[model samples]
Structures are given as C-alpha cells and as structure tokens.
Target: MQIPAGPLLQTINSPEDLKKVPKEKLHQVCDELRQYIIDVVSVHGGHFAASLGVVELTVALHYIYNTPYDQLVWDVGHQAYGHKILTGRRDNFISNRKYKGLSGFPKRSESEYDSFGVGHSSTSISAALGMAMAAKYKGETDRKAVAVIGDGAMTAGMAFEALNHAGVADTDMLVILNDNCMSIDPNVGALKEYLTDITTSQTYNKLRDDVWKMLGKLPVGKNFTREMASKLEAGIKGMVTRSSNLFEALNMRYFGPIDGHNITKLVDTLKDLRNIPGPKLLHIVTVKGKGYELAEKDQTKWHAPGLFDKITGEIYKKKFDLPQPPKYQDVFGHTILELAEKNEKVMGITPAMPSGSSLNIMMKAMPHRAIDVGIAEQHAVTLSAGMATQGLKVFCNIYSSFMQRAYDQAVHDAAIQKLPVIFCLDRAGLVGEDGPTHHGAYDVPYFRCIPNMIISAPMNEAELRNLMYTAQLDSTNLPFVIRYPRGEGVMPEWRRPLEEIKLGTGRRLREGKDVAILSFGHPGNFAAAAIRELRAEGIEPAHYDMRFAKPLDEALLHEALLQYEKIITVEDGTVVGGFGSAVAEFMALHGYKNDLKILGIPDRIVEHGTLKELHRECGYDAQAIADAVRQMRKQPVSEMTIPA
Candidate 1:
C-alpha cells in the first residue's frame, strides 16, 4: 500500500528543494501534500486534521524562509506533519508515530529543519525569542526566527510572558498566530473571544486594510525605513481604534487576519514580514481542517481519528465480540457528573482539557460548576484552591504530564493551605504514541514528598469510582490525588455502586506461599496477569494492590513482609522516588532485609510506542514480571532479618 505523493511534492526533498518549485505550482504542492497526508494517515494513523489545516502555511513558510539556518519553531507540534513532509521526510512519512519510527511532532534530533522540539503548548514564542536573541548576539544579521503558535496555545500565561519580553527585546522574530479556533478542543477564554471579535469585526478589518494600503504606498529606501513605518502604523492604530488589537498593544507590529489558505497571499505576506525587522505577529485565519469537509464539520473528533476510511470519511474502530471496558477518562467524566449531582460542594476544573480529562461530561451537565480554564494549568490549581477555601470540593482534573506546569500552585496554593482539592490525574503513565514529552512518568515522585497530599492510584474502574467517592467526602480533608493510566480499565461491568475506600489502606488480592508482588494503579492488572501465568507454571506468588503511595499501609505491609521471603514492587511511574522506592523506604525503616526487586518505568526517556510495547521494553509487562518471579524462584531466598 505505497501511497504516491503528488508529482510536485515528490520533487521537494527540503526547503531548498521547495524553493526550486515555481510559485505557481505551490498550490499543486499544497494539494498533493494535503492528499498525501490523507492517504498515509488514513492507514498509518497519526494526528490527522491539524496537519491538514496547516498545509498551505507550511509551504509558504518554507518557501519564504531559509530554514534550519533561519529558526522555525512549532508550538505544540500538532501542525508539524506538513512541515515534516516538505522537509526531506516524504519517503519515511508513513512511519509517523510508529514504534522505532518517526516522531509524531517536530523533533530536533530527527531533522535539522525542526529548529525546536515541541510537544507541550505555549512554548513557541519563548523558544523562538531565545533563538532570535542568540542570532543577534552571534551577529547573524540575516537570520530570522519564526514561531507558529495556535490560538488555543495563546490562552496560556507563558505566551503572554514571552510576548511581553519579545516586545522590548528588539529581536528579529515573527510570531505567526495560527487562528484555527481549536486545540484538541475548541479554544476558550477571553483571548478566544478577543480573537473572534478581531476576525469578525468588518469595521476593524476594513480600517486595518486601509491602514495597510496606506503604509504599503509609503517610500521604502533611506527616507522611509521599517521603524518609521512601524511608528506610523502604531500612531494610526492609536488614533483610530485606541490600539484595540492585543498584539499591537504588546509593542509588536501586528499584521493580518489574512487568508492562511491562500498560498500566494501567505507567501507574499511572509516575504514582506521577513524584511520588516523587530518582534512582530502575523494573525492568519485558517480552518482547523481546511481541505477535508468531514473534518471541517467535526474538528474535535477528527483531530486524531485513528485509521480512518478517507474516502468514506468513517473512523475505524476495532469490532469487539463482547462489550469492552470504557476508557478511564469516560468513567471519570461520568463519575464526576454523578458526584457533582450528589454533592452541591463538588466543582470541576481542567486546564483547557475538559474533553481530554472527561470533565466535559460534568461541564455539559453543570456548566457553571465545571470550567475549562484555557491552557492555564496554574490558574486551574489556584482557582480550585480558592473554591476550596469556600468549603467547595474542587476536582482539578489534569493530564499527569500537563500537571508539571501547575506544580507550584499545587504546592503553594493547595498543599500548603491543605485545601481538600481532589486532583484527578488522567493519563498517568506511558501514554502510547505521544512519547516522553507526554508521558505521566514523574507525578508520583514529584507529589510524594509534598505534605498534606494523599497520593493514590486505582487498580481498576471500581476502585477509581471508590477513590473518587472517598476523596469528596467531608471526612477526607487532605489534598487528594487519584492518578490513573490512559485507555481502558480491566473491568467491563465497571459501573459499580460508589463506596468510600478508607484512607491509608491496601487489599491483598491473592495469597501465596513465598513471594509477594506489591502493585500500584493500572499496573496491578499486569501484576495479576503475571501471577496467573506463574501459577500455571506451579509457582504461586501473592499480590497486593497498595492504593496509596503517600500513606503506606503499614499493617498490610507488615503482614506481607512477615509471611513472604521475596518481595517485588511494581508501578507505571519511574522507579526513582516512586511507589517502589516508597516500599523500599518502608522496608529499610523497619529493618526487614527481604529479597526485593522493583519493576517500573526506568529513569530514562522512553520513546513513543503502544502501551504494551513500552511496558515490555521497560521490563514490567506480564511476561517480564513472570520472568522476574521465575528468576527469583531459581535463587534461594536470603534469610530474612527483622529487628526484635
């Protein structure tokens, strides 16, 4: 199934090669590239609509800029697919997001054209500014730094911070605001509303056009320079609309609300901006799914619609003979709504990830109670703390990786105040295909040391429901964390009656003779499977699902330690300072010198792949666990030493 690129696209191996294509043929190139993306992604399965959206812009940027030398940074990397294809990766494009293949995002190691590696949002402006500043310092007068950032990413405070500095920095940089009105979900907040107002206002646009026309006609040599033009533009903006545009007010010359899909227009606009020095912004309006009709209608669903029928416009799903368990996120979404219905005090908050965290369910049912705080993770945490001060239970749902952004707020605002903020950390493991930048690998270690934080993980959906039930109770008055992995849980019939799980407790799932496997979170299922496999080989190992990492179940641990001679701890998080480390600490504190082994994500950058592949690669999958037990069985257990 070799997908053929358009004849024009086939000629482009790099931006240098793209520069060779006649300007008239760029539209054909865009069409070919867009069609190629559709053809390959329909079968290979990577991010779909975002790449499709930016095809024209990607071509325009490469054509105008001397890339690799001239730095170009993509904010979140969702739209970098077209960029990659144009830059010598056309042949290997099918390997996108596959195991041991191309990264889904723009990666610096992967290509010289990828000036900055990005996975998280709202980082492009700052990163590009740095590159521009470096070029200035190095006296590279002709060099330019361009950042392609989305409207959704603009909602984050970090973007504003960078814009504030970039305004006065006097650097040769361009911030291309890709206003698609979406980032996985629809863009929210005042910024979104402001962008809408700018794009929609006929009066503003007409005046803007007149101003641009007047500025264009001004003399261009020594008498009238770029600075003079900038000042004149600023003066006109101040006099007419009181400088209504946000980017203009930041002291950066702002151009556009231009048609991003018009390849010629984009090329012309970018060429002109390259000559106009200082920090500037180009606000180009484009649809999230520009060429695809189905994607344009339903942008969110088509964002990453995995292995679709491109012709039929049907997203493929694996047909199951029996009912499969729902994703943990969906369960969280429904359960949070259920909890909100029961408790008037319960409110939901997510940092522009209501849909991702499944809090969208609650948002739909109780709009006022649940909020999408744009891309402001810190604001979400602090806002949750504020609500907690009023005795309201706020479940601040965030992706485990994204929560790293709000660590300060979690510590200073919530944990220090001991606000009973229930932090539901979704995708709290090696999230498949997203790679290291998105893996929820450090949450356990990061949060474990914080006092007044009750860190817990659920073994399955029932346990997750129970944990949520417990965390919201008035009796539970700590900053609670319930971290769960991505994708489906083990139980199909998981809509169990919500019951409160006692704090600082664990349950022994299986009782065996010599060895005990201490498991945490979703990886408990892996441990159970390994135990089953070992049992078939006439080796029975005990298993315990220790729900809480912060508060070790000393009684249960004591029971296991006394009976079992060999102990193995398993967690989806990093072994360093994680649940396994916590267990090791407990063992060390009590002076129990039993044979111990820890299995989890090693302290290294794990690349993108399927969850099963990552688990096996990290040596914690069922077979790996079973192998560990068998290896331990072969060696006689060391004599256990306990303090009297």
Candidate 2:
C-alpha cells in the first residue's frame, strides 16, 4: 500500500506549490517531507540519513530560490532525495533506487530541477560556480547558483581548488556547508577538527544566537539592530571567538553556524542571502539522522542500512544458523589486521572509508598503522608511496571507482617508482543501485596498461586471501592491484592460513576439447555454475581462472588453445581495453588465432540495478556464458590450432 504524503506535502507537486505555502507553516511541510522519506525508504530501501539531515534546507532553498532558473547543485547527491521529492517526483519517489525506477541521486535527465548530475563527492561547488558564471555571461544577473555540500565532502582537495578558483573569478554563488561531522564514518583530519571547533564553541554559538535575538528584541527589529547593534556584536564577538576567516579567506561572504532544522530561520536566512552579491557561504549544522533516534545514535551504520521496519526502526534481516560467507570487504578488513599483526612493515590507508572498506578493523587493532586520509584520494596514494619508499609495506585500500581521482599519483609515485604499494580495490565491478558514476568498470583497463603495475582479481575468498598474502611477501617490489567485487564471498571456510600464489599463473577447473572459458575475478564462479549446466547437456567445456590481468599466463593460455577448438574470455570490467582486451591482444601477438570471444561490460554506460541483473545485461552471467558457448560451437569456425 502506498503511503500518502502529509497535507502540506500533498499540496506540493513542485517548488511553485512549495512557495504557495505560508512561511510560518513551512515547519509542518518539513515534518511531512521527512515522514514521507522515512515511509518510502522503510519499504523501498535507498540512502536514508543524509536526506533526513537536510529536510529543512531542501524546503528553504526551493521556497526562497527560483529553481530550474536559479541553479541548485547537490554535492555527492545522496541528500537530494528531498530535492527530488519536491520537484514533481513525489509520486514516483517510492521507486527510488529500484531497477528502471527513480534514481537515488539528482539526475539532469530526470528533472530540470537537477541543475547538475552528481554521484561522486566534491563536484557541486565547481558545477554550481560554472552555472553561476554561465548565467552571468548570459546577462542573467538575477539568477543564483547554490551548492549544498557536506562538511565531510568539503575536506576534499577538489572542493578547495574550486573555492580558490571561484573566489578569484568572483562567480555569484552560494555554498551551503552542511556540517554533520560524519561521512560514511566519523570524519578524520584537520578540516574535521576545524569544523568541530566552530560548532563546539559554546561561547561563539550563544553569542551569535543572542545577537540575532537582540536584533529582534529592538523595537524596530533586524534592520534597526543591524544599524546600531552591529557595533555591539562586533565588540562582544571580537572579545569571545576568532572570526570565521576560513570561507572569507577564499573571498566568499560566510554567514552561518545556524540550526538547520529551524525551517523558519532557514527560510529567513536564505531570503536574506539570495539578495547578497558575489560568492557566499552558509554554514548550517545538522545531525546526519536528525528525526530518527536510532539513526542519530549510530549514523554511520544507518547511512544505507538495507530494508528496515519504519515504526520499530529495526532492520529487516534473516537469521542464519550456518556460518554465513563474509563479504569481500570484511575478509579484507580481517586479513589486513592479521597481516599487520604478523608483518611489522604492513600499514593501511583509506580515503575516508575506514568503516565502509572495513579498514576500521585494522585501525582498531593497530591505530598507529591504519590511516584514514579524509576524502583525499590523490593524497592517500602518494602517502602510501612515501611510506613504501621508507621500506614499509602499505595496503592502500580504495574503492575502484574512486581510484579514477588518484590515477596520476598511482602512475607517477607508485608504478613508475616500482613502489610495493598494495592497491586493494574494493567494489571493482558493477556496484548496483548507486549507478554509473559509482561503477568499478574502468579500473582494470585503466591500470592494466601502466608499466610495473600487476593487476590481479580473485575468483573466491580463498583466492583473495592467497593473493593478499602473496602480494605482501618480502620478494614483492612492483605496485600490485587486487580487484574484488561488492558482495559476500563464496568460501565460508575463508579463515584458512594465507598461502602465497605463484604470480602470472592460472588454475584449470575443468578439461574439455570443444571450447575453453577463461574468467577473471568472481565471474569465474559464474562460469563454474554455467559449466555444470553445460555438462548436463553433454557440453563439457574447460574453465580456467585467469588470476592476473597484467602478466597474462601465456603458458596456461597456450595449453587451453592447444586443447580446445575455441576460446572465450570473460571479466566483470569493460570490454574496451579491459581484461578481455588484454587476452585478445596477447592471442593476436602470439598468432594463436583460434576463434576468440570477449565478454564484459559493453563500451557504454550501464544504469543502476541488482548485481545479477547487471551481469546478465552485460552478457557475462552463467546463462549468458552458456548461451555464448552454445552459439560459438554452432558457428562454422574450425578449431583454433597453435602455430607449432
């Protein structure tokens, strides 16, 4: 059953409808909006906490600014659910993050209200500034561009770079600093401390609030207060706290440290700020999970807590008696702790994903060694290289998609110098629901061509353990990349002793004469399932787990080509310049012209869906593998023979 939006929210179909509601009644509207989000997310399951944090801000922005004309860019966009709901998508909001349904984040194609599409963090300021500059160029001085970025996102180098550029360029832009003091995990480093110091200054907040209150207390209210009481504020505040010189130093007028949930105050502040000229900053403090007690208590865990009971706030979960297979990330977290415990040189680094990547496990065990670098990917990579130069073994764990940010650092500092930086790339394939920007499709192809880089993907938990073990061996020197997928691993007995795997070698699972299927990473498990079905049809094709994409196992590949009539290479990465492309290149170079088929992500963008659905669409699922083999066998191509 579909839940109805509250009376105030029901009247709102667009921002135009939102503006019709009296300013005094906006709090009721925010309440309705927040409930609607909880109701829908309780059933449909999408990002929860971030959107909940910005309910009042979303309402205030739409109510104050002329959206679709005055641009609004949401940084990272996880918090844009409320923005989406207010902008004619309320009816379809329940379909958020579902396959072929409403996208979880703001999308330009989805709505005119979404001025810029966003998924990755720290792009909003730049995007909004560009729009602001474009509007100025077009002589539309009345229009405004606002970027609502979290304090966590503000820690990124891109955000600072944009601030530096925008400050000098003098773009008419507003940046909303949503300080919740958390991003997936509790934020780390100097910026976090700085933001915390501002928010925690009891004297500063009380003085600022009292000044605004005193302005209202004057018989003439704010205008009169600004005229006369401004001197008093300057006099008192100067004695108490250091001024907010941070945003001002970047040449943007900063106004805030205000309560985010106060809809009336938000509206009033926004109304005032809209009239201001040049770049401006509004620092609004919000709790990550404001309305809900459970999420507020444990914000990081609730960031994207799957499906949950809305009323009780209990996550819907299955109880299992049998030991469940650990997620690839958990295995990594546990393995790293074990490795660091044994090897004194082992150190871990992550770019603000201590909890998400499970590096928190190692950080807990060895706080000094495991470092959280606070949304700075390029810095994380270079820091690892610097550490590696000092003969320390560094496991630089980063999301595969996020590595796109630090590619240059990886090439110059790690690969070129042959630093033994163990790059454990989690989420290396289709990351379902988060969509194209978050997909780990490009990492394999992007890094494979880099010299002195060893690219390896494990087929299961056991192989992943072995690969991590093998990479950390004292003999290892070159930079190594271990790519793995998102979900649970197949091996329940994954806690076995870590054994070193021979580099550039593959293990054959089955033997056949007709065709040989080569697979890399977790996709080999899919191939194994297909092999069983093929055998049931008396189609016994051979299977080989090609562990490494960089150093192609020419000996094993030659062995397969000599035995089989055809060859098929499958990977979860892109077909263009990926693992499959590497295989094709090697086959052509060696003059082994046996009929070859490459299967992977097609050379186009794939939208959000379940992992299995995406795999099937990309034609690498078990059924797709079976169909490919059957089709290849039916073709009138002769068996490939080695040029002996």
In terms of TM-score, the best-performing candidate is 1
Question: Model 1 reaches what TM-score against the true structure?
Answer: 0.97
Between which residue pairs do clashes occur in model 2? Answer: none
Q: After superposition, how far is residue 617 of candidate 2 from its true place, in Å?
A: 1.3
lDDT of 1 by residue, 250-287 (tens): 88888878999999999999999999889999999999
Full-model lDDT, candidate 1: 0.91
- Show how many residue pairs clash in every candidate, following the order shown: 0, 0
| Deviation (Å) of 357 in candidate 2 | 0.8
User: Residue 473 in candidate 2 has what lDDT?
Assistant: 88
| Candidate 2 vs. true structure, TM-score | 0.96
For candidate 2, which ten residues in a row score worst on lDDT? 234-243
Q: Which clashing pairs does model 1 show?
A: none
